[model samples]
Target: MIRAVGAAIGVVLAIVLASAAWVAVVSSGRVHDVADAPDAPVVIVLGSQVRDGKPMKFLSGRLDAAIEVYDSGRAQAILVSGDAHGRSGNEIAAMTEYLVDAGVDRDKIVGDDYGLDTFDTCARASDTFGVSKALIVSQGLHVSRAVALCRDAGIDAHGIDAECECNWLAVVRNYAREWLARPKAVLDLLSGRPPAVVTPPDGTLTAVSRG
Candidate 1:
């Protein structure tokens, strides 16, 4: 019985390691610094926690990176994707307000309130918003998974690492969490489940593209 349990544990560990490596490989050569990031129709800022209508540090870092991309003329618009119904706060509203304050034109910023997770954000960006190519902005530990999942969702997606002043302990914790999250991302793809919330194409991106 002990040997069987040990073997099962080993298998699980191997699977976890392999999945993490796979995600990293998929995103290899796809992450870029702001200056090197390629031009695209839009930049997708993934959501994080918000408090009292204010973006948390990590989320602000992502928005800052997206702003850099916009200012560089690499992207024509910004898509802030997050949970509108999150208990912490309305992440979409917080993200939108942050961008507007940063001088991003209000019309060039679109919000996806149903982006409850990384996969949902990517899937919805492709299916619901008709986004073909985009730059995804997130922290270093998360950019690989975001890029991998976005590619799997059929978006020509690349990633930018959002710089934030996180302590070593928090950074290590986030990296460890990412290893576990990558396997679930793989499962999400293999299961072929649709995004939890689907809606008609909003024409938001179309308007942005026109401008």
Candidate 2:
């Protein structure tokens, strides 16, 4: 019985992993660059690690891509979404600062401090921020999942790759993580779990507030 149980568990794990791999395969090529991304009113700049109040290389690349899209007139506004659990440690703050410093209008950026993950950001973008469509910015491995989540959240969305060549480790790590994440995303959508945060949609907040 013990050997049988172990074999069954192994089989289950293999099936799960295989399903995840399929998800990633089908989800690739969904993320596009600024010139190729479909038009949208807002670009959701997905958050990443920050250090010393600055965006790390990966996060910086995402901001740069979003800014490019905005400058190119592909989008009118940007929503920087990420975890902001503690007062002193906020990814959105760093993202906002980076964008503004990069010459993006301060008023053109909005911060979603409660977006703890891709799903949270997408849900809030639709339910709270009233974002009907958006271009998501993140690494190639990540943008596909982001596109899937945002679409699940009722937003028409596309993804733009933000992965930096300098962060090869990030590429490997994110791809591994995404393998698991893609499968989980499908389950989460099916389970109908609500996001961590939501606010009544604010129309003006959806617009360029500071510019």
Candidate 3:
């Protein structure tokens, strides 16, 4: 019995390693610096924690990157995806307010309040928002997984690493979280689970001016 359990553990560990490797391989050459990122119809800013109606540090970095993309004209619209029902405050509202305060046109922004996770964000962008091609913005440790998941969800997706002032300890913690999350992301793709909330394409994204 001990030998059988040990062998099963080995198999699980191998599978986890393989999944992480797959994400890295598939996302190679797809993550670019802000200057090199390709133009796309929209830039998707994945959500993070909100504090007192403002984005926390990591999420602020993501918003800042999206702002840069918007200013460069590489993306015509911005999609802020996050949980509206967050315990602290409404993440979607906070994200939108941040962008508007940064001078992005309110009309050019759309909100997905049910983007509860990375996979759900990608899936909803494809199915509910009618986004075909997009640049995903996230922190360095998380952007590759976001890019891979978005691509698997049928978006012609690329990624930009958001800048953050993270301490070494925070960085290490985030990397550990990412390592464990990759296998779950792989399972999510293979399982083909639909997002928790599904709505018809509301034409909001399509209506944004591309010029």
Candidate 4:
């Protein structure tokens, strides 16, 4: 009986800790424009899963929002960060294609296919490319975490409101999952090499240069 009681307590503690970690970084005020403030070398587009090189609905939403921000003169350049596990299955590539389709200049889009995870993506931006201040585009629920992660990595970052919660159920589920993801993000800051500047190679997402 005592063992069972201890197990239950452990479970509850884990959940509580996760929830607190998530709440510590979230805020309704984080949604803002990175443009018209200061010039940032790059705008890091966070990764989301793709389907056969195509963006899933959620992923598309982020791309669409980022495109709008791009069009509005918010940022001069875009960096698509995502998994490049497959030669053809690349989220950043899909995102670049989407942006180009929406009339964004091809030269402004940069792809960072090495960002396999959120922390890696942000760190790569700060360390790999010398991005100090950047606008992270994602769903409202996710932007806070992105901003927090960027700050943790010693980069000045802010979030722009890119996703809406039309479906409360999905939003709640994302929030729930984020609770646990926050701690891992914290750990990422504690581990890794120092930041370094990397210049992005020039290439269009679907083979067309905006220039």
Encode model 2's per-residue lDDT on 1-211: one tens digit a residue: 9999999989767866765675556556667866788778999988888878888888888888888888888888989999876443679889988888889888888888888888888888888888888899988667878887888788888889774856677678877887777667777777888887666676754657323
Error in Å for residue 202 of model 1: 1.8
lDDT of each: 0.91, 0.80, 0.92, 0.68
Best by lDDT: 3
TM-score of each: 0.96, 0.86, 0.95, 0.75
Question: Which residue pairs overlap in candidate 1's backbone?
Answer: none
Candidate achieving higher TM-score, 1 or 3:
1
Instruction: List the pairs of residues colliding in candidate 3.
Output: none
The predictions' CA RMSDs to the true structure, in order, are 1.2, 2.9, 1.5, 5.2
Looking at model 4, which ten-residue stretch has the lowest summed lDDT?
Answer: 202-211
lDDT for each residue of candidate 3 in 117-163, tens digit (9 for 90 to 100): 99999999999988889999998759999999999999999999988
Error of 4 at 21 (Å): 4.7
> Tens-digit lDDT track for model 4 on 112-151?
8787777777777766666767778777557777877777
Q: Lowest-scoring 10 consecutive residues by lDDT in candidate 2? A: 202-211
- Global CA lDDT of candidate 3, please? 0.92
Cα lDDT, model 3, residue 18? 95
* TM-score of predicted structure 2: 0.86
Q: How accurate is candidate 4 locally (lDDT)?
A: 0.68
Order candidates by TM-score, high to low.
1, 3, 2, 4
lDDT of 1 at 27: 95
